[model samples]
Target: MSQPPPPPPNQPPQGGGFGAPQDPPPGGFGPPTPPAGPPAGPPQQPQPGYGYPQAPPQAPQTPPPAAPAGPPQQPYGYPQGPGAPQGAPQQPPAQPGYGYPGQQPAQPGYGYPGQQPPYGYPQPSTMPMQPQAPQGRRKLNAQAAIIVAAVVAIALIVGGGVMYAKSSDKGDDKDTSAGSGGTEGKNDNEGGEDVGGGGGTEKVPSSTSAKVLFQVPAAEVPKKDVWSVAGSWLTDKVYAKSGVSEVVGYDPDSGKESWTLPLSGLTCAGSPEITKDGVAVVVAEDAKRTKANPYPDCTEVTAFDLDTGKELWTKSVAPGGGEKTAFKEVSITGTTVAAGSGLNGGAAFDISNGKILWQPKVGSCEDVGYAGGEQLVAVRKCGDYGNEKYEVQQLDPKSGTVKWSYKLPDGIDNAKVISTKPVVFGVDSGEITASGATDVFSLDDSGKLRAKITLEDGKYEHDCGVNAVHNCKAIAVGNDKLYVPTKQHEGAKQYSRVNEIVSFSLATGKPTSDRADAGEGYEIFPIRMDGSNVIAYKNGPYDKGSQVVSIDGKSFKETKLLETPATDQVRSAISGMVPKSSEMRYTGGRLFMAEDLISAPYSADEKDYAAIGFGAK
Candidate 1:
């Protein structure tokens, strides 16, 4: 590039110039002077083409009006353009379009007229500013709705799974056919074919194989009428008794007497019990003696051989006799015999050879009994003045070794032990109230309690006396049912009426029947599983003598069997009597009942009664 030329000297070299003054004074040149007034003449006329009138020369003007204040102007330098005033001095151009000092630069893309270029290059014209969409509110709403729907679906699936699990846990598909008709096991016919549409090919259950082969005619006792009948399965013989103290044996098949053994100085009072081995008879006798010498007046238990009426052994437990005992209750099993007495403590005897096995240390006992299978069970009440309490003990039947013992509640006046297959059921009486209470306890083989069912007198309110056996009555266990006879109070006369029969489910322990209602002055004993039909016996509604009535155990409907004529003598003596097994004996597959009938003579009113038997056909 070519360099520019230097300025002239009169201009003071371009930008450094202070040019010479335009005009000067004429004097010594020390300073300029003003011109005198135009020569006194007519005003100078204007020239034709000059455009302005000229001043007439008088003297030179001083110093060109004394230059304006500030630095002198330079020639060939920057000119004061339109932005600057006409005669004013010019300032330096603001450093190539920069603003004044301390002023901020114009923002990029938006600046004053002539500024340097911005830093970033220009962008493409086709690129839009992109209007910054509103973040798609509709899409966000849709996403939120999807999350909520998924959560609800998961909740519903989990709830359905939980319900299905609960239903499956209950085992709803289990077969319930065994519980039908309140019976257990299967039903079949005799010809090995499924009977009653049961699935099995075997017609009948093996348990029904042994049907009733035959039944003998009912036997009648002589002289005093029949009081009770005891049968021996081992000898196929039946023992019958009347008012007399002798046991008369009859053939079960012929209904004829085989032998009559006289009981010397002893009278039968309670039922006889047979040993589990079916070899002996346990006969209870009440001696003829007064309470002053009640020890000698106590009861005696005699064991006799089943084949011959020969007495094998005798255990005399008399009140105040040596031990001052009064035998109240007696029960015998395979290897043991339990006897409860008034004074002498309850004792166990060896059934093989009549010998005292063991005696518990307790007061005089009232009712003593035994239950359970191989493990012998003994239950008894001790104490006098009706303040009796019960004790349950498990012992070895062969050696009389006490395995365990449990003390019952203080109020229990009486107790009975019931031995079903897997458990021992204890039905006990509460304290000496007028009606008393019944408590049922289920015990394991180890003498531990499993469950309890307590029946209070106030809850059931039976009108029986405190000592009545029918207050809570007896419990009989059958195939699938438990029959409990409960005495409900009808009126003021206590212990004089037949009350109710309550059947409870043996499996579930729930009441199965409506309370069975009985008439006034009647007595009932519900018995089931006697070969074919379930039966119950009812006595009385009699004005004088005893009247006998029977009912179907399953239906609770009544069936009249026999009715004896009424007599005033019998009415004054006997209160009531019901049929019962003499010795837990069954003949020809029929449960033998011992009937205690009052022998009322026409001339004298007597308190004596006879025992007899009625064979169910």
Candidate 2:
């Protein structure tokens, strides 16, 4: 299939490391744009439903002077009404899908040129509807003579700090050996015992309703810059979140800070996977930011125990004693810690001792990022600028050996690994959708492509972070299926919009008939898989509180797990944490949500929340 080329040689570098970032719309990025072309037919305007944000009100219109009565002249030169004889202002075409109740739908010209988002497609917005942060560093623009030049700038400009900071993995380096030893007191089971998927320790409660346990206030940041707080995780007893320059562990039940693991600088990226024993990895800067170096390179990699808040080891790579190597993301498969970059290549380290296991030399090819869990998968970039190709490879976690590799089609600039075990990933073939994907490809164990599920641009709604491979939201994988939420559409109630969670089979790449509905004013999205079942979140309309539910993988039945308070304060707190851009975890009847980036407040009265936790008895 023909895919969209990356920014032309003359264009500036886009921000995403997986691909390149496109600047968000000026007023703030809204929903995905509708696909190009007209809809099959006009549908009724949809009203804002539960869970979705309401649109801002418009200025009250002043009544035009009474029209002169001459053969019933049209009023104020307005177009004839749809059914009226003439000169009656026609009602605006029903807004696409669900719209803010009583609010005028934004006129066309925002997303793709179209009549409306088709069934199963997303409706674009004219204004910012949700609070979100970019996954990668802010994209900067540049001028170049050709597409190749622009592509090169992508590495130099966007790759910036990361390009200068990759660590050398030469076997003879004394630093490699010196940094491999653990710094903290060692535990007997550190390397010997297996800790499969670290969560799922708490028991489910009988009552599905929940109460807010606590809310963490955000730290005051400089008005000129935003700080990255990109990671959060849940264990049986602790919920860990990234702070300014530390990872704080809070008692899950009381929301009190139990422990803090300080870092050399600001936290940049974190591994989503944790060992059964609560060991995880994060990337930070080698030094704190200063006016001279407003944005320090993220070079420090630390492995720590989440439960005890113990720092096992911290290491940074500086090839040939040059600038320290910086990493944009990290992952763990078994005991191997894999850190990747788009410009300098990638390296794997021993999770137990921080030993340099392997660091591949950068040539025409580089490992851009990795998705780790039961398998360690790398998305490698090869070829030259303007003619680059991407290959997805399954690697041996300990040895960094490529077990198998699958090449993406040419012209496809980016891809994200959604699931490693099932070997499923998404690609933005034409770069036409806001979700950064146009199709999903599923592969067999041998790396043979099985089925391709077309998203048809914005027809389906889902998101995988631009810079990181494993940072996907509103999606779940289980029972040989991939689950995604449909775009919101009109519900049974007047002015109400709702959405549903549907699944696509990995073996066939076709959507199954089953669906879990969010009912009349809610939008349902999957969080993660709990065994064969899917844990989901339902965004409620203004009057109702949001909910967490578990959907049976086979039957598609939903069991309510928890619901937040519907009071205005609680509603604002819970609804403001959108799943697409927020760090969220729901495990063992406990739900935690946090922001990825906290910027200076826009106004004095505006409240800032860093994180919030909820629990059921």
Candidate 3:
């Protein structure tokens, strides 16, 4: 290492470091030279290798080994420091730079580019260097280059921070690359708008104009038969059951005819239930069919592929002598579709081959339906007719054997099952009375009584064409609780007060949220299920009002989701006033749910029909 030329005569070396004092620079160490303009950036690390306050001074020795020849190209990684072109002719070495003993060569400071040296500092040598050993030059250049790289790296990082801060201040996304998810908002279909999916615009309020997916005009089909329409996202089509012995399927996306298959000498015996695999329906052999008695003949079961309109298979089902609708209610599981008859029994048919799977010894006493996910469940009269015992049987689909059975308790006074999931809701005899036993019992998975609730004063059982459990608007499950319509049962305590819509916890049968809504004379009925909430339709005595409410299941908060179908024809269809000729659900879609709003074309006018819509947002 070269000695930093010794300090002039009288002044003691100012502690071995870069600022060591000289004896008055031919005059005196007057004022310390100002660091050329404030530092261009955060303080540079004392020019790496320069002697620190504690570092020992270099021992007197020959000058540092010369840097190798064959000049290295300017580094390509970073923008060059401002001054001369990066590769400009190397200025002669000035003050010695600090580094491993013999590694670094003396060079001008790169800080404050283009600035003159501080007073008393040695001037950069204008003389060119003598050629030296290539190996030695390489070592010297690499060490010096490292110090330059460090300063460059720090500058770039600080620059990046400033850029990001500026972008945020401008209220734009910082990520500027394509598909960087920097856009704000989205179409209604791409919801989460706030919650799920991706970062986008907030969803429009329910009051805003809805983007209609599709609406089928009423004039195309008979007004009375308008409601036979049913839709399913699984099958991706709108389905309708014509009483005249045929089923029509329409594409949900465009409302075009997907396919229409005839029943061949049979009438729709009951409302059909559809699954992605196929559609299950009960029909009557053409014999006893009449305008008044739709299924007066014997029973027949049919399965059709809504995807292709091909008849998968058909089976003759006779629930036995003179029983009504022996093949009425249809449900599907795995590969088997089962149809339950009035009282005779339920028969499971192979969904693919139409072969009978199995028949149970004991048949469901009441209408048979599905329960507990894919299992079949029904209320069956177990004891002799004189004694009359009723129990719910969870049946095995393969052999029709009883998987488990839960019997109704005595004094419960005739509780019939209404829903099988979320919770087992039973409709007991008569409206809620003071002395009456609990008409509604919430049961857990093991069939244990979880909680008991009574009905409201005016919430009596009524036979609404669509849903039989009219006391409650509709059966909706949210946040592990079953929400139902209930009035303050007579003499119940404050904790049990469920005025309009009551939430019964499926696990414990306790009231979780005070989630109920209604205005005078107009009670709220949950008509549709949204994510984890229920969309409610406010129905009063005379007509269906134009208020659509949504209740959050978790919080039990209610928000006006949408205005009721505004068109009179659509309103009439929703109200169920006009006679619907068909018996099917018309509304269907994935991102959206649409329905034929009117039962038929408006007869008073000429040809006009409508439908209502509700969806993701």
Count clashing residue pairs per candidate.
Answer: 27, 19, 29
After superposition, candidate 2 runs with Cα above 4 Å error: 1-204
- Give the clash total for candidate 1: 27
The residue-by-residue lDDT of candidate 3 on 1-617, one tens digit each, is: 96432211111121221111122122211222322332233212222111101111333355444434675432111123343234332321333121101212234221222322222211112112121113222211211222232223222210000000000001111110000000011122332213222122223242332222333332233322212222222233343333234555554434456676676543424322345344545454444334564323335666766666777777764333223233434555556666654333456777778887754333324433433223456555443322344566666666667766666532222333344443445543333332122235555565444444333223421112211111122444545655555432221222221136656455433344454656544445555344455555444322333444556655666665344333333333333321111121211112222221223222232322222222212
Local distance difference test, each candidate: 0.35, 0.59, 0.36
- Residues 1-617 of candidate 1: C-alpha lDDT, one tens digit per residue: 86522210000011111112122112111111322322243222211110000111223334224334665432211122343224422322233110111112112111212222122211212112211113222111211222232222222210000000000010001111111011111211233222222322122222221211111222222222222222222233444332245555554433345666655323433323344333444444344223342213334566665546666777754233333244444445566766554223456676667787765353354335454333456655555443455567776676666677666644334444544233434332323343333444555456554333334433332222122121122344443445555543343354344456555443333345434455666655543333122234444454632333333445555544333233332222122122331222222222232322222221211112222222222
Residues 354-438, model 2: lDDT tens digits: 9998774636777878888778899998876556677889999988889998876444555688888888788654433566555
* Residue-pair clashes, model 2: 19
* Candidates by lDDT, descending order: 2, 3, 1
Query: Which lDDT value does model 1 have at 422?
Result: 35
Error of 1 at 537 (Å): 3.4
Tell me which of candidates 1 and 3 scores higher on lDDT.
3
